[model samples]
Target: MNTEVVEEKSTKDRTVVRKALTYFVLIALIFISAIMVVFEVYEYRYDYRQMSSLLRNEDDLNAEWGRLLIEQQTFGATAQIGTRAVTQLRMYSPPPSDTVVISLPSTAQQK
Candidate 1:
């Protein structure tokens, strides 16, 4: 009878040990999953910051491009060129009486 009692007690102890081990494994899995979630959140925030910086850089470049286009237009205008020539270089258009026309010989005629 004592031997039977000892066997039953050992079986109960084994069952308790198995339950504890199962609970420990489940808790470990939950902790690991929480850590992974935190890591993913950090990565997401980092990517958002980098994207924001790139967008700001793109906006600055676009503004610079607009300025450059405006400068080109100012430089390339015919009126601006004529004004600069007249004022800075003392150039003028000739009167009709002083105008002369000279026609160059054509290549076909020379041949």
Candidate 2:
């Protein structure tokens, strides 16, 4: 009877040690997983911030391009160019005095 009790106590001790080791392993795994998750979250957030800054720069560049296009169109208007071309190139449009009016029969004027 005493030997049986001793064997039972030894088996119980072994079982408790195994349970403790298993819990320790599980806890360590959970801690490592939590650390990895934190690192991934930080990296993702940093990348997102960088992407946001790049997007802002692109928007700024697009806005500048739009503004430049508007300025170009304003300056390149047909009336503006016609004036500049005439004055700067020493060109002109003749007045009515230089125009000649030829009167002919409608049937013969078709050519």
Among the numbered candidates, top TM-score falls to: 1
lDDT of 1 by residue, 1-111 (tens): 999999999999999999999999999999999999999999999999999999999999999999999988987897888989999999999999999999999999998
Candidate 2 deviant stretches above 4 angstroms: 78-80, 83-111
Local accuracy of candidate 2 as per-residue lDDT tens digits, 1-111: 999999999999999999999999999999999999999999999999999999999999999999999988987897788998898997887899998899877986786
Clashing pairs in 1: none
RMSD to native, candidate 2? 7.3
Report the poorest 10 consecutive residues by lDDT, candidate 1.
Answer: 72-81
Alpha-carbon RMSD to native, per candidate:
5.9, 7.3
lDDT of each: 0.97, 0.95
Among the numbered candidates, top lDDT falls to: 1
